[model samples]
Target: MKLHTIDTGFFKLDGGAMFGVVPKAIWNKTNPADDKNLCTWAMRCLLIEDGKRLILIDTGIGNKQDEKFFSHYYLHGNATMDSSLAAKGFHRDDITDVFLTHLHFDHVGGAVIRDGEKLLPAFKNATYWSNRQHWEWAVNPNDREKASFLKDNILPIQQSGRLKFVSAQDGVSFTDDIKIKFAYGHTDAMMLPLINYKGKQVLYMADLLPSAGHVPLPYVMAYDMFPMKTLDERKIYWNEAVEQQYILYMEHDPVNECCTLQQTEKGIRIKDLFKLEEM
Candidate 1:
């Protein structure tokens, strides 16, 4: 199996929201914010080529939103989904599965595209993957999360009759070498892919662990539906990651593509940082 890092580019998010209760004075040292108090982050996605199936995890924020909407989050950078795929000698049509970690606009936005007056699935040949629980939660979103679950980025997959659900069971096998691990703190039933690659296990840290800077136990995000749940999940995952020596694939880390954790004097901290290709 071969894995490629698909970078859709970078976007800015409020530093406060990304770091939750962590004070700006602290998080600022690691992720400096711009004059607007927004920190730049990468919309990094992962592509797995296993046998006949080419699976993509997370579609990044797409380009269908209006100017006013996009003005909120400044999307920048030259790398696009198509360009990144082409660099790997592939195209959107070559994708066999799109495994969305969640239905948030930034994560699943590129799953659909605007075609005339209708919104349609971008990858015409790929089967979109989501879970039943997350599907229901996103479709009937709460007031707090409704803004992130845009209808334009979501409904089209189901409407196109290409959406499929993985079993909600934790540790369910998505493929012979890939397993799904569910986290409820970020949103309901957010699935993180655990794949066996090149004699090592790679864990796709969706929003569970957005960056290596968030390795501290208290560095939970304010956007999480349940911050305490996230703290608990992080403790479990961080310990397991250290014990199992898993390479964490960061989704929003602007600089680092991947990292490993080591038990530190304070807590689980970043041991080493490198790119996915370095594996």
Candidate 2:
């Protein structure tokens, strides 16, 4: 199986919100926000080429939002979903599966696009994969998360009759190399894909660990509904990652694409940093 890093684009977000309780004095050294205090982040997606089945994991925030809506996030970057895929000699229709880690706008926005008056699947031929529990939670999001679950990004997949839910429970295997791990803290039933690639195991650390700076256990995001639950989830996942030597594939990290954990005296900390292609 061949794995390719598909960089959809980058956007700016409030650094304080991204790091939650962590002080900017610390996070700034790593992320370094702009004058507007917005930290640039990459909406990095992954394309899994396992034989003929071309699966694109987590489409980045699409370009359907209005100018006023986009003014808030400040989306900037030369790379886009279409151009990035074309660089690798493929197109959206070549994608057989759109595996969404969660329903957040930045993560699943590219799954659907606005086609004049109608909203439809960006990949008309692909089956959009999302868990049943996550599907329900996103469609009826609470006040705190409502903004992230945009109807334009989500509802269209179900409306297009291309959405599918995996019956496989938590820690369930999706394919011979890819396994789905569930984290509830970030959002309800956020599925992190643990993939085996080229004799190495790589965990797609969606929002659970958005960037390399988030490798430290206490660096949970304010956006997480249950921060306490996130702490526990991180402990469990980090321990396993350290033990198994998993290469974490970060989606939102602007500079660092991948990192690994080491058994530090304080706790598990980043042992090394590199891009996915470096591995």
Candidate 3:
């Protein structure tokens, strides 16, 4: 089995929103913000090639939104979903499965594309994977998360008849190497893929921990619906990761692609940072 890092692009989000309750004086030490208080973040996804099963973890915000809508996020980057895939000698249609961690616009927006007068699955050949719990929560979103769960990015997968649910059971293994770890602080049934890569465990740090800058337990994102739950989740995962020597594959970290954690006086902190190729 092999793994590929697919960088969709980068976008800006409010620094305050990215770290709730954590003051700028603190978070800015890691993720500095612009004058407008917006910090740049990458929408990095992962592609796993396991025999006949090719799984894509998440897609970026995409290009279907209007100018006004995009202006808000300040999308900026050269890498894109298609071009990045092509760089690795793969194509969208080559994907066999798309395991979405959640249905946020920045995560699942690229799952669908605009084709003439109709919307359709971006990877027509891929069976889109999402858990039943998150699917229902995303489709029927609450007011706080309604904006993030765009209909065009989501409904199309189901409409295209390519949607599949991950086994609702936690700690389940979809393949011989990839296991599922569920977290609810970010959203209901947000599944994080735990891959046994190169004989080492690599945890895909979804929204539960978006970036390396968020490693310090208190740097929780305001976007998380349950900040306390995120704290507990991180404590449990980080400790286990450090104890087991797990590598963290960050999804939204703009500069760092991956990292290993070490127990620190300031709680869990980065032990070493490097590209996946370094593995």
Model 1 earns a TM-score of 0.99
Error of 2 at 163 (Å): 0.5
Model 1 whole-model lDDT (C-alpha atoms): 0.96
lDDT for 16 (candidate 1): 98
TM-score of candidate 2 relative to the true fold: 0.98
lDDT (tens digit, per residue) of candidate 2 on 194-258: 99898889999999999988988899999999999999999999999989999999999888889
Q: Best candidate per TM-score, number?
A: 1
Q: Which should have the higher lDDT, number 2 or number 3? A: 2
Higher-TM-score candidate of 1 and 2 = 1
Candidate closer to the true structure by lDDT (higher is better), 1 or 2: 1
| lDDT for each residue of candidate 1 in 1-279, tens digit (9 for 90 to 100) | 999999999999999999999999999999999999999999999999999999999999989889999899999999999999999999999999999999999999999999889899999999999999999999999999999999899988999999999999999999999999999999999999999999999999999999878989999999999999999999999999999999999999999999999997888899999999999
> Candidate 3, 169: how far from true, in Å?
1.7
Badly placed stretches (over 4 Å) of model 1 are none
Q: How many Å off is the CA of 157 in candidate 2?
A: 0.4
Steric clash pairs (candidate 1): none
